[model samples]
Target: MRFIKRLIIGFVMVIILGICLYCYARLIEPNMLLKKSYSVTVPKDVKELKIVFFTDTHFGKYYPQEKITRLVDFINEQKPDVVIFGGDLIDSYNRDQELVNIEELSKSLKKIKASYGKIAVYGNHDYGGGAEPIYEKVMTDGGFKILRDSELTLSDLNLSIIGYDDYLLGSVDPNRYQLPDAPFRIVVTHEPDVIDNIKANGSLLVLAGHSHGGQVTIPFMKGVLRPGAEKYIKGQYDLKETITGCDATMIVSEGIGMTLKPFRFLNPPNIVVVSLKHK
Candidate 1:
């Protein structure tokens, strides 16, 4: 009887500790910035291109406009040639109150400066009922051009950025957007699952968000509750034939905010800065 009581007490203590740790990680740690750096080899003649990418800013009770300001500040500091947003700019799911002040969010996002341009795509959360149009307006007002299953080329930079709509809420016709031959080709999608559907058309890099790194992951076991994440969740992936037989690298961002429940454990938010250089 004494041993059984001790075991039960130990179990309770572990649960309590887990709750405390989860609260801190979910609330405090998610707000912190994590800068991730990577280098991709491009053509020899192409000059090095710096890219700053972030995504999944739920911009609701979990993520506020203040965080957007901080993110913009950090992005400007990077002095990227191109800035790209993966998506999920808002969160208004069955809530009577507003998630974030749209005007302030727009203003803060506009503060981000890039040499080529600042681009964005829509995410699943952005299409929640009546919030889709509002989110699009915010993105446009903030100077972010939404790329919905389209391609934009920078003649001077000799680079192309391909934007795909949210896999869950929007249609994805990879054949519609052909990857123009360029020194660097980048594809941005809201969810990493799109990688499986689209054949790589000479794209060098693919960037995605929506998984939020499982939002609540444990070590070794992989993200058990990753809704948006299909086969790939977080970090980098080397694909051989996933994209039209051409090899490509796919990067999935952990994202800066939370959804459903404002709780994160083990996984933290991140900002990715990818530098394209000569081999």
Candidate 2:
């Protein structure tokens, strides 16, 4: 009799603990935002630059558009010289159209001030769910220049920013166009795994967001990794031996929103701020 009673109590305790974890993952963790920072060495002649990168705000059923206001404020506080968005802006444009207010979203995005410019690249989600038609417009409306398999040169800084198309849904050919003889280069993509395919020479820094740092991470076991984010889950990776064959560093942001499961465990949403200084 006592053994059965103890078993029942243990079962009840397990059930209660599960409920508490569920609530924390679904409610508390997802709402928390963290700011992560890193520093990179550039040529001494090049001017110092501060770049703020954020991405994967699914912004549909799980993430609200209003949060962008707070995000913009947070980014502005950093006073970044260049602002780069890694993509996955809207979760599902088809289903979330009603939930997102275009004008408000654009206004908030515009308010995010960056002296150099705001650049963006496409994510798988941006090309999927009927978002292609309006993704460019939305981002452009918000003062972002979309780089699809293209390169942008910042003459004064002697820097080149190359953005590739979504690896899964869009076309990506980093070598399609010849990059200028810029001393510093920054590559932005939605998926970090694609970095191995990039062949940029010289000092390089890559920024990506898609894994969400295993949105629902567990203590001992691995967290969920999306299709394109299999190899590089999150955080920084020194890719000196990568296919790029150049000395390079990559920083993958955990991102600012939730997706498929609508829950965030050990990993909280985050924006990455990178400082580029003379070597």
How much lDDT does each candidate structure score? 0.80, 0.88
Model 2 spans > 4 angstroms off: 177-182
Please name the candidate that would achieve the greatest lDDT relative to the true structure. Answer: 2
- Show pairs that collide, candidate 1: 200-243, 200-244
Candidate 1 residues 163-273, lDDT tens each?
998878887775754555544578899989777765544437889988888887767867644555868988999876676656689889988887778877776778999
- Output the worst ten-in-a-row residue range by lDDT, candidate 1: 91-100
TM-score of each: 0.90, 0.95
- Candidate 2, run of 10 with poorest lDDT: 174-183
Model 2 residue 85 lDDT score: 96
Report lDDT (Cα) of residue 242, candidate 2.
75
- lDDT for predicted candidate 2 compared with the true structure: 0.88
